[model samples]
Target chain A: MGIPVTIENPKPEAEAGLNDLVALVADGMARVNTTILSRTGSEVAMIPEVANHLIASGGKRLRPILTLACAQLCGYADAEGRDGDVKLAASVEFMHTATLLHDDVVDESDMRRGRVAARIKWGNEASVLVGDFLLGQAFRMMVEVGSLRALDILSAAATVIAEGEVMQLTNAKNLETDEAAYLAVIRGKTAELFAAACEVGPVLAGRGEAEQAAARAYGMGLGIAFQLIDDVLDYGGTSAELGKNVGDDFREGKITLPIVLAHRRGTAEERAFWQRTLQRGEIEDGDLETALAILRRHGALEETMARAEGYGAEARAALDAFPDGPVKAALLGAVEFCVARAH
Target chain B: MGIPVTIENPKPEAEAGLNDLVALVADGMARVNTTILSRTGSEVAMIPEVANHLIASGGKRLRPILTLACAQLCGYADAEGRDGDVKLAASVEFMHTATLLHDDVVDESDMRRGRVAARIKWGNEASVLVGDFLLGQAFRMMVEVGSLRALDILSAAATVIAEGEVMQLTNAKNLETDEAAYLAVIRGKTAELFAAACEVGPVLAGRGEAEQAAARAYGMGLGIAFQLIDDVLDYGGTSAELGKNVGDDFREGKITLPIVLAHRRGTAEERAFWQRTLQRGEIEDGDLETALAILRRHGALEETMARAEGYGAEARAALDAFPDGPVKAALLGAVEFCVARAH
Candidate 1:
């Protein structure tokens, strides 16, 4: 086996959890998808072309779904004038897609969601401008919702995500990058948006601070779990399973959790190998396979999943304040779904 | 003369108008500058590095000054709890700077404000991410002000700006792009922000809709005039005067007003020259000089300035309802200053 298969019987956790989550938020998701399509429509043909290219590419619409589910869990209803959650959820997706477009450009990525990257398809200039258009559209939707609190959450998250990107850039190819630094980067890049997406749901519902905090914590935990699983899958999962090429993070010299773990646990010779391959970006033909072997030898993938499980547990715990309703159950299942990518 | 020197003795219009306007809103401008500096500060080293590289690169701060001056013209005072204009003005600068950074990247520019472009200094990735950071900060500041109307104005402007950018992309190097299409491009790319900047001031001061509309009109007119002058300067002005390389627009094959005018009036051979150099992008040595000779032959520069003057007069007319005062005079003078660039 290219990767050590620790789970003798891997459960279909992602399939089941995602299906249940989608069912729980089906109506809201439908409205959100419609809102996304309508808002992304522009007189400028290039705007729609670039935006739709990314939006239409199949990826789980998890962040927006979380927004809707959290709103439902908070008991928000249209009667209470909280129907703006639908738009806000769509805004969350736009923000996510915008970041992805910019991220692909930053990463100089070749593929996304099993297809050529937008940057590769249209060029870097188009990717950057289209990303800006999406962000502008996102802010417009947030303004339409007329919630200063929600706007605050989402805008601040946008800043955090940008900062996270910069942080990731600084840490890339630096084998000396530590776990705390890794956590901070992921928090800014991945968890912050998730936190904002879920937190705004409560803000839209006019829920109390505790409820908002709980929702935010749930999202942050799930997001961290999701990213951790992503890091592991980069080394071990198939493109069919992950919807992206395996070893991409390696090629990009991204210092994810497994890399950090493997580096910390490695011998002096192994450290030199990482330094040359990752830090110097001088990868040879078999470096990726060797990296995978090193990761398995150090139990890095296993430990990374264990860490993801911990975050998943934390994510579930954050939903304790809400009653054990369908929304909460779906949300808890999302945490399971995200972490189960490692399986 | 390449363009008609309508002003026999050219006044320092931009310099004088900017000085008077700054004096009128000196306190607000200072505060706005402070807010800009503070908001752009981040723990991420690359963000500040890339952002400051551009923010300090000697932009005239014209957009923020307009924001402050317009707020003052609307009688917004800190005593009346309209101090948020200072923040909003800074936010406007942030938005403008953010766009400039992205624009340089999109345009593949090597120089900005007589210095190397941020993209050259850092990278396209840094410039794009830092630009996003500034925009996120802009939205956060808007949210802090808690004015949905102001947010609405600015957010809509942002979308329009993005659309304008895409429109420009589609129109780039196309010889057939007409004056109407050119006007539409400038309206989206340049004037929308100016209109939004001025309109938000009135919104903050709780002015009537007519007053807001007037302010927007003034800004729109001045902005179009400003951009018209910029297009003229690209061909005739020195690098020292414009803070960018002359012929940049021509080199990039940007179909500006002058180009449209020249194309419409050109002989068949001249039209063929434009098609080969612009539409087909086979730019030969000394093609810029030939293009200049053609613009002069058609009086495109003079006619472009005439159009700008008309808009300047319209801008002054938009302020007709307001009482004569230092602010109003400075505002009117700004129109002269903007259009005077053609002289």
Candidate 2:
């Protein structure tokens, strides 16, 4: 009592809806994390250093969690007490991490996940090669799981993701990019992996085509919603909350939904501002604030959030194929969490 | 007067030894080329543009030819007239092409196959992403072949290649890198894929582990010889013969065998030159000539060629397990061709 006892500040509550999904898959994710760490090891020291910088960073393991939850929903059971889902979950993470490495290099990004990007910390050469290493390791892990169908799904997803990235590159700073084109790009780059991650789970669980389709649809819907929110947060949220600099899309002149919507709806003068700052790469100091103000006035961020909610609702409905359970509830909660990130 | 059509310059006789192997695999190679063209097509036009720029360029296509030759040596015959070897051959080429793309970026190489590198013509971002697309497509084609064992072999080779690339990166411009380290780097980057390419052929042909081992050993030995010759040609051969500028390795300060040998065998003064030019990146005009003189003074290039001959002999001896036939003869000749390139 003599010592002025002070209690540590109460720990901030975990992100509301995502925490539920995270808690539900905590056991599976532990196994996945173990697999990820073990598989990323190489005699080449730089590989694990670069890969773990991103892998061990605190981004939500949302995609792998989807893989685990989908497998559980499909009633996956293995006699040897070794589920292929764990390896597959790790594989999913590797693919994601590999893409992130390449993306940072492509975008010349300085920060990622509230930390300096691997490409910036390491060199671009290291980032590119390490990304390739992780991708190779990902395929190796998939082969070990011995599921041809799963491999097909994931490999095809990878191809689509690459195609999407190139498409996005072509679309960057092009104000003429319409919603349909934007959707195609995001579906290729982002949604395809989510779809594959969810689809592989049911395939490994020995579930039939119907369940697989349901899982894929759910993942696809949720992934689109997730990306839409990401675009919104790039303009509407803070770096501390987003784990990336706010208005990074604007800085990079990346034409996302907000930019697409705003440009289409903007007056000639406002469009000129976008063209100068984004298209022409003549960004001035106050441009991000101007971009944000333009986005708010036009309600572009709100409309994007609305579209995300629509996709989230669809993701929720896709899970109706399975009986209501903790896994299913958690999956639905994850979708809500993705959409709610805008707020 | 019969229009004296000037007879086209008599086609230079194909390199004596490699021509035999190429002729043996010509029919299969046609199918493989078709598969490659069809597989690389994407709705994203830049992918095919960048990919075909390399694939359609006049490189020897030696690796895919090895896959086809090994399958024939294993007496692969598919009843439906659809040999998985064709697809596997294409997959092997895609992997090689993907590696070439990434390597060009990592090396900042300007010329490849006597043409501008795709990375320079397009951009590093496109090169990285398109290389990824090709890798993904390679795996997709492997999965279509429905051989999990083949997938395992190739995927493992890919991981090793990436690790080797990283190892090479670490070794670059570092004078302390020794011959053992150099060999390790090449084995990981070069021989592993060759080993896998040859190993998968017998696996697809339903051969036993012994035959697979023989094929793998042959490919491994041949691969080492091939890379040694490549390293030699970089210094000793002409730009037309080598299809890349001579002294590129020296300019890049790459720590290959010649540099390693010369540095190790040189006098204190010579070592200082190497340390200043390579280790410290203080290369000056005429540095390449000085490097060449040092290498020649130590007989480094000749010793490297001798080493290639030794490996080529081992590669040839590996064919003892197969009956004496055209395929065996062609394979042996191919090894000789690899070594003879040094001349």
Candidate 3:
């Protein structure tokens, strides 16, 4: 052998775990997909066209699945056939979809979910307006559910998510960003929404505060782990795995944990390279490859994944309060699957 | 005089009526303004900066004033000092401000309320995010008031507003956009918010459905009138009076009633002129003057104002069910003031 390089293989168990969670929520998810499709319709044809471009392009409805699974775990049966959980789950997805649309526009992203972004197909104007349309529809659904507590959690999450995006904007291309700052940004943007999505389920079921808190904690940990894994994948993963360009974070100068660790553990010359490529946005032909090499040499990706594993462990622990049922196992497995995606 | 042109002078009574309404809602307006300022704060500096750039640059607070006036008219005394109307008024203003920020970005506007737009100063990303932040905060405040009805009304209005905006985008630069389509667009974008704002006041007061309907009717009529006057002023009003650059709508080839009326009534030659200037977006120097001359020749501006007057009459009639009081008179006067702004 020339070099005997170590290879990390994809975990079948991780994929199976995700599938189990999906299967567990299949019935509710079907209704959610239907609700989403029907609600995106408007007299203005462009609204639905733009919305469906992203919604129809599959992104793995992880957040809504979490909402539904959490609701079921909390003993929600819809005895009166209110279907509040279904509506709330749909609302969660809408909020997530709205943020994705706006994020694509903000990042000037070209592809999302392995297809041309809505912003690219329809102009940025349509992307922005349709994103607002989805967000408005999300709140309307929440109001229909008639739960002020759910509204409070989701709306506050929306505010924090916006703040996180703004913070990310400010941190973009800034090589001095530290790990704490990186965690703060991701917590606000990513984890907050996950927490809200999970918490709203228990609120809908009228579960006790302990159950809601457990679900919220689990989601928060899972989300942090999810984002960390995503950041690592942006460097180490393949385009097929990501369903988008692999080096988008690097190309966009998006500051993330991997970049932060790499910058911190780098030499003076490497730091200067990052400043030139990211801060000043000057990239040569080999800049991406060079960046990857630096990250590899510093073991930044592995270290980031380590942090993700830590969060995943916390997520698994958070579900300990629930009875040992298939739903709980699936939720815990979600945390494992999220972390193992890096392999 | 060479032509003995008819002159329309500004009405002092109309101005006085607006001032009277403003004075009546002064106490609540102050609280609303304070709430707006405080709620815009975030740890991310860019959010408050972008938000304040619009909020402090003061567009007339007519929407919130209507909310307050309508609440007072419905016999809402805030007996327990809940200040639901105050919070609701602030929320209305926030929604309005969020729409304005997004609208400026969608239109790619350079100036708003006599100040440089937030998008221009901070870039479109920040503007869009800040707008979302404000909208999230709007719903949070509505939720805090514990009124699902208010949330329903406002959320529905937001969805309609987004649809209207999309419709308007589709109609832009299209000479085939007729009066009915134009009316639908404006009613969705502008009138829906006004109607919801007025209706929420009654909802907060726990008034009867008829009172809520009447308030909504008044708001819808006034909003249509207000938009018509704004359209008329785009070509005829002064820059100082409009607080923005005149001819922006023409420069953007935005389809409005005046353009529709002028195009519908124009000869073949005039239609070609409009097609070149508006439909093709090939505006040249002196094109605005030519457009104004064409509007005057067809009496489009006057006819538009006459239509606004008719809506103003309907708005006044909507207030007929309420008892005669300073608040009711002030609300009616506010309608007259909106229509009179064209002069």
Candidate 4:
């Protein structure tokens, strides 16, 4: 008679891994925060205005934290190669922020970080142009750091991210997007930055190629897990936690993992329902509830969470290259924290 | 009764300077063209579809040509530092093309390069993302050249260009925007890249700081002249030549040099006419003609061309460091060609 309420869904817990990583990298983070605020400042008022609207918004700054933590894990202390780490960390954050501004416009979402979106605040033209400004500043910082290897990694990541965005656009609202296709989208959009952020840390620390590879693998797995959980949470999380309205991905017809699983498991009639709501954009009032019912009936949410947990494990295994230490422990905990959000 | 056609505005002539530059750099230009096409070919179908829609549409490729000519003018022959020149030249062209894609989206243009605009053909989201791809590739090529100074200059130009775009946004449709403000906008939006494009060539050629400074000055002056001529042509040139709809600036409320002069010199009635049409968007069928008449009455077009020619002279003066040869003559002639577009 109503939408199925799955018992597999658990209450959202405090993100301990994120908190630990934040505290562990507090000093490096302070430097990064300063770099971000300073770089966003421009003689052109609109550049800073639109940039800070989102940058100043209180996201976890997790991507930069990953950069700092990964660098520390690789034994890059403040005296040795810490300056490069901090600079690269800030660069990663700027790149992330720039993508968010552009992504909001592309997705036509009106909210970001629980506030009115930059596109809504300054208009799409301002958002797009300011995003370019941030990206330009990101590259400037990368050049200042003067690490060709780091530059190569981050610049390639930028290209991959853009390509991923185009790939996502091509797959949007398509009922036929499969798990392989879904993984490809997240790998580009989310995981590549995560991988680049972690990989660059070891490269700057003068660590061996093996350490860099481990860092890249760890970050990529963590990024995939994090995004999978995000896709999961879009259906059920609170706006306070999400910083945007729930059901956003659904509203936008993003072909995320749960939808892919649900579509595969549902009946022919259920498939038609999804086709009408997602592909054709005939989202009725109770369509979200019905979609949830079908997803739960087929255990799609639990399966999606299980897949995220698998990725989180892979991420932890990648960190095993480092000897046991606070930094390593914190990174593993961070992986757990990413998957825990789905609970 | 009709729009005043100024006697100073002669019929469009053959672009001798451009033709000469192209011929002088023909070998390097061939390599650059190859790099551009190779880098732009993406696995994702939409990216190339949107990118090549603009890139292959017969742009003058003036920026890349400048990079080649500047390097050759500094005595960087193919046997010496020619490979880097070709890559960087391609990089400059890619950067220019990226900006064009974003510019069309920002301006909501429906035409570019005498064809339907990329935004119209693929939508804003596709255009913006593809532009990012080109920029990412541009940096990749810059990094491969292994010149930190070149990367620094180009990256800084990218940031300044974005700021200029925002400045232009602030000045749009505002009759109060003066000559100084207009110059600042163009300096950021246009001249910065021009300056960087020329400066990087000398920098890569192992040239001294003095030579680099000279190249920067040459590029800055040429870029200013080029942009001023573009502004003039926007009001009077054919769509075939301008590669955009004429009177676009007027319709969009852009305060270019011609409008700045006319606004400074116009009477109360004429000022009100500008305010009503440009500031308030109350354009009538014959308003473009009326606007042209006002421009002619103040000799704004002719005076704008004079300012462009002045900058062209400055550009030629900056080339004094280079020895007399085919490259030097071609660069000087290129300046003449840019200004000659007005005639």
Candidate 5:
């Protein structure tokens, strides 16, 4: 009933190591999944019914997978390590789900992942309530993790993400956007989770503080790279893969990185087009095409790619502290995959 | 500028004890308050400005006081005893504040304690973001409490509180709001915090399981009683003293204790009124008075008061485990105050 993140694209050939790592995650995820999804166990009709609808919408569990992968890669023992690795992984996913639920409500987005959003299906009240339910579920999962350090990281990440959202709102349609600001927003909103997901693994693994920091950094960098690519894909990705109406950002008057770069390099004529349109928070026909042309002319799309590459490199560097193993290698590939994925 | 709870009621009497606690909480809250009341320290400019208005609102530290009082009554030591008490108490306030910030957003409330609500001031996006910030700050503060048990209790409470919010939203206005069902919601939303406050005290005091559970029970029962009183006051209390808009709950289409009781006992004619006004999800002119009269006629208001009294008695029973001392007496007074307060 809610906006579930659907992946319509055919599964890419996950690198061999990544595939194996995901198989391990799938097991843990199934175990944690039951508890995370049960928002209302009450006999009350409205609650359990509406709750069931929201939970029934499947999610990709990207954040959880990153957590499980990072923990396994960092050599947190599946056999001997703490239970937190799985719970924390679930916690991250819960946090992610809560945010998405709230995001749909805030954006007033009617559909997500090719289905009517929860807000639309159940009403804004249900959407907001379910969002709160997911949040509570996240904290419940965190309590099971029993690591204050992990709680601190995840909670802090949530705060930062919220701030990022606010920042995004205030920046809507103001065309003087730049790379630095865009990156900052991305890091706060998107990267913080990516960072938290990866970082929590090290902490849960009982890895030393240094390794934990390293993992955190890796997640942070990868998250930024991932978000940047997402911004680009919003402009370029097909409807089937993106599960979004193309040019949603432009239509919503969001000033993303490509637009920021193009705006930076605009000629007087191009500048006039945006100043009269985008900066004023208005859109005209073919505005999306014109914006794409500006990005191409300024080589802004390529610059955006270059920035993603930079973050990917940084993410890789952050993982250097991990022990050399298949899991580590898999984590490395995942970062690459994070940036390189088509959708 | 947003409505401020701070301006609504400044606790001059509790200020000394609370200040000692505030001195401890001020730094973390200041940071969280800044981040919460402000934007993400990124590109967007309006978030922080909006946040500032909401954070400055007046609110009493009743929850924290209960936490500190519980600890003091249990003869808790900071490791350093009193100093520890202050920190722990402040942690309670921080958590409560964090929840408040988040609650306003979830509820889409436009006012708090006679001030413009945070969401209205900052928009839903910033309010939500700041609320997240406050939650994170709360965990950070708890971490400073330095006990795994403290983290566990607080985390569980956080989850329950969120769940309570969900329950409240789900349970809104259908008129099936039975006493048992209503208690569950109140426990999740209100009692959990009160219970956490008391339990955290004993944990800090290095008390045994029996004492901790007893203290937690005391807080939980008190919270329920307190909420019952709140519902009662909503119908009867003057807006001048309560600092809340009268009939706002009805306007929000909520089905609380009085209405539930009235629905059960009212005449067929009254049932028609209830169905049309409450279940119909709209309160028309003079409906508040009519509803109040129905409640009185059916003894619904008195029944609610009696239920609150029963919980208050139960709250006192939970404290029987504690010693006979001034701290214990204060804790008792606080419980009484929770239900007995005019505003």
Candidate 6:
């Protein structure tokens, strides 16, 4: 389905585990990073520059944090044998960083998260190549974990991620793109990594195939929900609320779900607004208001939120296979908050 | 020391070990290809379109060839450990294919080995992500080999190659590039995989540090020489000789050693031509002829060949440290051809 089905929101009390996951993500970032940065390059001149820029660029570190929470919930609660956990998290981060560098190059974008992108600051060539450097380094980190299963999971996720990126490229500026195709693209581009992160945790904990698969499913649903929310925020939230410029995607000729739904369900006049603003790449001041109005008139925004909520519900369902525990609760909370977060 | 001093040319002859190495590479390709294709993607619809284009446009498979050669000369001459040798060869091929995909994207070139470039066929997004897919697949293949040292070698080489590519991006059309800087670039961009290829052989063969290092030294020197001869071929040979246009580098404004030395050692009148054609990127019809003449007149071409000879000599010296064997002689012959091949 292009749009996700609607699901009831979970209890607010579920937020407890989500907060813990966030803090766990922060700790994982500091711990895995020291080793990762040191392993980057032995050469003195370029190593620090590369590491500093990479470290300074703050991210949610969502994948690593998920990994920690999954491992904890699966009953590997202590830091003992956490090397594999840390390394997998680092691997996810490396993949994330690499994609960022390459994404900026492909988009020819200069700015990301309020900082000049690596492609712009260091030059496109460096950004592209350094992205590659980190990808290889990530593999090196994972190999020491000594699990073929882990390698297979991460590698397959990577393939999906790249394929997702291509799917996005193909889908760009095409108003006819339905919600099904859009979700497929996101599955590859974003959800795959999340799935890999959570899956790797149970895998490292030496769980059975069923549990590993369950964790993986949980991650996949959560990652999709997270990205869906991100897309929704691009339209619904303000700059201060979402910490990004609103209406930026429509301006860049990108076709998010809100546009997809509104274009299909709106009146002829509403459809024309999308065609002019998106297909023609013309976004004037006050166009955001017009676009938001069309979305509201067609009930597309609510529909989009419903889709994300469905994924969040599916993500929570994946955790039902695991036993009752704080970690499981935390992971479940993460899914709810991921879709519900305005920012 | 910017340009390597010419080492004495030895009339190298073929050995059986080298022939076996060739067989090993060819066989490795045949065997691992099933996994490579399947791993790239499972969609039957997309397979013939995305993966086939690059795979069919075959270069010499030189990277893997280097790995087989490394294994043999490093004393893995016994056919007993064929899988290890083949896996390494396949791993190197994976890395090379990945780079080729990425390079085509960054350069935005249309022609590769007289066929439409992969990016041109699949589009930039497919090209980029497929490249990422191949890189991820490469790590998977390396994991299959089950050696941490092999993983380290390939991973380190991958990073260096990326860094080298970035360095080249930085140096594009900048005539200020010197011989040492040029050498460093080549080492990263071209020589790294070669060095790793050769080193892995000894490591796989269960050799000690000295032998592995010797194989590595040989591979690195031979790769540099191979690149030097390629640059020379770009200037002195025809399209048929080099597999594509002879002067494609000049057209794309790449300042290789031929131009690097000409820029440094040419007359004032000649300097203007270098500045305009290579540095200024205002190359025209007559510039190719004029640039060729300047290379000849200043003896830059001869000197460039002399550098190739020097690297070739070092490549041979690495072999002398090895005990007498058929594989050793074959490795020697390959290095000789690397520097002396007509193309």
Q: Which candidate gets the maximum TM-score versus the true structure? A: 3
Where model 3 places Cα greater than 4 Å from the true spot, the runs are A1-10, B1-10
**Which CAPRI level is candidate 1?**
high
TM-score of 5: 0.87
Name the top DockQ candidate: 3
Docking class of 4: high
State the lDDT at A7 in candidate 1: 38
Task: Score chain B of candidate 6 by TM-score.
Answer: 0.88
Where does candidate 2 chain B have its weakest 10-residue lDDT segment? B1-10
Candidate 3 lDDT tens digits, A1-343 = 0111222334788788799899999999999999999999998999999999899988888999999999999888888887899999999999999999999889999999888999889888898899999999999999998989999999999999999999999999998889998899999889998989999988988988998999999999999999998888777666665677667898899888988988988899999999999999998887888888898899888999999999999889989878999999899889878999787
Badly placed stretches (over 4 Å) of model 2 are A1-14, B1-14
For model 5, the superposed segments whose C-alpha errors exceed 4 Å read A1-26, A32-59, A80-82, A275-277, B1-52, B80-84
Task: Output the worst ten-in-a-row residue range by lDDT, candidate 2 chain A.
Answer: A1-10
**Candidate 1, after superposition: displacement of residue B114 in Å?**
0.8
* True C-alpha contacts between chains kept, each model in order: 0.77, 0.78, 0.81, 0.73, 0.53, 0.51
Candidates sorted by TM-score, descending order? Answer: 3, 4, 1, 2, 5, 6
TM-score against truth, every candidate: 0.96, 0.96, 0.97, 0.97, 0.87, 0.87
TM-score of chain A of each: 0.96, 0.95, 0.97, 0.96, 0.89, 0.89
> Per-residue CA lDDT of candidate 5, range B1-343, in tens?
1122211232444234334444433443444334333332333456445544554565665676666666666666555533555555556665676567667766667777778776776676666665565566566566656677887787777767766776787778678778777888888888899899889878887889999999988988888988887887777765666667766777676788888888988788998888788778666777877877788788777788788888989988988887777667666666656655522
Q: Between 4 and 6, whose lDDT is larger?
A: 4
Predictions: Cα RMSD each? 2.4, 5.9, 2.7, 2.3, 5.3, 5.3
- Sort all candidates by DockQ, best to worst: 3, 4, 1, 2, 6, 5
Considering summed lDDT, which 10 consecutive residues are worst modelled in model 1 chain A? A1-10
User: Taking the tens digit of each residue's C-alpha lDDT, what string does model 4 give over B1-343?
Assistant: 2233443342334376678888998988888988888999888899888888888898788899989888887877556543789889988988888888889878888888889998887889998899999999999999998889999999999999999999999898899999999999999999999999999888877899999999999999999999999999888876655677678888988999999999899999999999999899999999999898899889999899999999999999998888898888888888888888777
Per-residue error for B52 in candidate 1, Å, reads 1.2
- Candidate 4 TM-score to native: 0.97
Return the TM-score for candidate 3, rounded to 2 decimals. Answer: 0.97
TM-score of chain B of each: 0.96, 0.95, 0.97, 0.96, 0.84, 0.88
Candidate number achieving the greatest lDDT relative to the actual structure? 3
